[model samples]
Target: MNKTILLNNRPNGKPQESDFKFTDSDIPVVNNGEVLLKTKYVSVDPYMRGRMSDAESYIEPFQLNKPINSGIIAEVIESKNDSFTKGDFVSGMLDWKEQQTHNGKDLLKVDADKAPLSAYLGILGMTGLTAYHGLTEIGKPKEGETIVVSGAAGAVGSTVGQIGKILGCRVIGIAGSDEKVDMLKSKYGFDAAINYKTTEDMTKAIADATPKGVDVYYDNVGGTISDAVHANINRFGRIVVCGAISLYNSTSLPTGPRIEPILIKKSVLMQGFIVNNFSDKFPEGMDQLSQWLKAGKLDFSETIVEGFDNIPNAFLDLFEGKNKGKMIVKV
Candidate 1:
């Protein structure tokens, strides 16, 4: 029997694990041009929050009583497609099931030896590309400039900070816990890190960390932290608005200080983008990320929850700030 997780109901505010229901089904049969996959790892990302609601967004909402899907790394157990062979590893945005039958054209066959199979769901995959395209295209960080990243301990933010360091910028990270703060400074090569959950004055904390004023702001967690960043932005600063994990669970629209004044005063350029906006450049991004990974310039790590049943709790953990990096479920 194959177990799949489905969204049982729409969340009211903060999402609970009970919102997900597990259904047991028979393994899907492969058709011509299709391959049967057994999931090895599934990515649980923050962006899925937007898909859960019926509200308008770039992506369509997930249908009720259906399986929720994200990136997953799987192995081809049976192949009807000539392009894929049994035992080949592949990655794709397929259903949230233990076994799936997917068209071969929709999957990218990944080299298990080139990088760990799990890295396909993290650094060498969507998260890394999101950081790269957002930083290079929108944020436009320059050498010797001060860059600050919010939610700096998580998947996208962690990669953003390290890539900033590689580009010769001073990077400061704001996270929730002291442990994450230490990881940012010591392991992720951030110049300074602040634990916002304990900080008395976030504005002052940010100012203290980036003494030169923030030149590039890669925003992941928004709200008060964004207010502070806008208040202290350098002249002609650039802001790449990424995920707002801070406001994802809000039932009502979140209200905060207006930012137009700072935008005008600093001549800041603020842009919001999704990773697929640069889909044409994915190969280019992946090549650079792969080279960097081989050269030890980029580090990819994960906090994996074992078993298919834990997927929903792992997804909810993103709201709780429980994940250290890319959160995945191993089945």
Candidate 2:
């Protein structure tokens, strides 16, 4: 039997656990070129929220009453595929289920001995790749430049800031809580961090932290915090617009104070990208990230939730800013 979660309902604004349905079914028999897998760890990301809606977007929305899927770490229980054998660890796009029978070509065999299994679903996987592309390709940070990353406590943001430090940039992280601020500064080695939730006069706070002005902006939370970053941007700034999690739950199109004047004034270059946009460069990015992790120039954190029953709650908590780094569900 396999337990799976389905998208039971669509959300109007902020989602609830009621939007998901948990049920059980038989694990399918594997055919040639297919491998049967046992679910290990599943990642819950802000982009998954976009998939819940029926709107037209870069990726198709999750259909109602169907299995919800994302990046998952799994173990092969049976293999009819020549590329895989029983007991091999794998990571790929798989459903929120206890088990899966997938085409071998769709999954990548993971090196559990090289890195922790959960890492393949996070820091060494899609999340890490996102940071690499966002920083190097778009938000090009030169030495001594002040780079600001919003949502700096989350998985991708943390990685971006670390990479900024590696490139000799002064990194400033903006997170929701004081504790996350501390973690960003103390644990992640960010030059400075701001507690967006507690800070009054956000412009002044960021100004105080980056007196040189923000030369690179790795935007994650796009809303008022982004507005604050623009208020202190430097000339020829590079802005990488990644996930706009702050407005993910907005029922209507978000209207805000315009930022065009700021961009023109600073000659800022702003680009919005999905990780898939840089697929051709993935192997290169992964190799660099792996080497950094091994050399201890990089680090990661995870707020792991136990049990399949908690998956929905874990995902919902992301919008509320509950997790410190990558949020994963261990089944």
Candidate 3:
């Protein structure tokens, strides 16, 4: 029997464990051009939370009474496709089930010996690509520039900060907790880090870090922290609105410091982007990231929960800021 987590209903505000149900069914048979895969690791990203809602977005929302879809690293158990054979390792979008039979087109065989399989779901996966595109294409950090990134200890945020350091820029990170702030400075090599919870004045904290003002702001948690960053941006600064983790679970729209005046006065460019919009550039991003990972120039972390039943809890952790890096479920 293959166990799966099913969406019981659409979530209201924060998602509860009761919103999901665990079910079991027989392993599916592979069809032509399809492969059977045994789940190894399943990524629980913040974007998945948006999918739980029925609102319109770049991707289709998760339907009520269906298995939630996520990026998964798996081992091939059976293959009806010539492209893949038994015992191959792959990463792609797969159902949150113990075993999955799906079309092979979406699956990409991973070189396990080169990098940890879990990385294919993280640093070598969607999150890493997001950081790369947001930083290079959107933020456009220059040498000696001041770059500020909110949610700096999370998966995408961590990558952004480290990349900023590699580009010879002063990187300032803002996270939810002191420990995350420490990780940003110590492990990720961020020049400065601020814990939003500890700091009463966010704008002051940002100003203190970037005394010359920020050139690029890679925004992950959009709300007050973002507004604070906006308030201190230099002329012609760039803001990449990657993911708004703060507003994802809000029952109401959050109000923050008025930033339009700052934007107009500084001529700051603030743009929102979905990673999928840069699919054509993904291969180049992955290649560059892979080289950096192998050269020990980058670091990444994953807070993994064991068992498929923990999928809902893993997702709930994201909203609470309970996770340090990329949160994944090991099924």
Candidate 2 lDDT, 258-302, residue by residue in tens:
999988988989999999999999999999999999999999999
Model 1 lDDT per residue over 222-285, tens place: 8898888888899999999997888988878988998888889879999999999999999999
Which should have the higher TM-score, number 1 or number 3? 1
Error of 1 at 315 (Å): 0.5
**Clashing residue pairs in candidate 3 (N, C-alpha, C atoms within 3 angstroms):** none
TM-score of 3: 0.98
Alpha-carbon runs more than 4 Å astray in model 3: none
lDDT of 3 by residue, 1-331 (tens): 8898889978888889988988989989889989889999989888888899988988999888899989999999999989999999999888888998878887899988998888998899999999999899999999999999999999999999999999999999999888898899999999999999989999998999999999999999998888888888999999999988888989887777777888899898999999988999999999999999989999999998998778889989888898888998887
Q: Candidate 1 regions off by >4 Å?
A: none
**Where is model 1 poorest over a 10-residue stretch in terms of lDDT?**
292-301
Clashes of each: 0, 0, 0
RMSD of each: 0.9, 0.8, 1.0
- Using lDDT, rank the candidates from best to worst: 2, 3, 1
Pairwise lDDT winner, candidates 1 and 2: 2
Per-model TM-score versus the true fold: 0.98, 0.98, 0.98
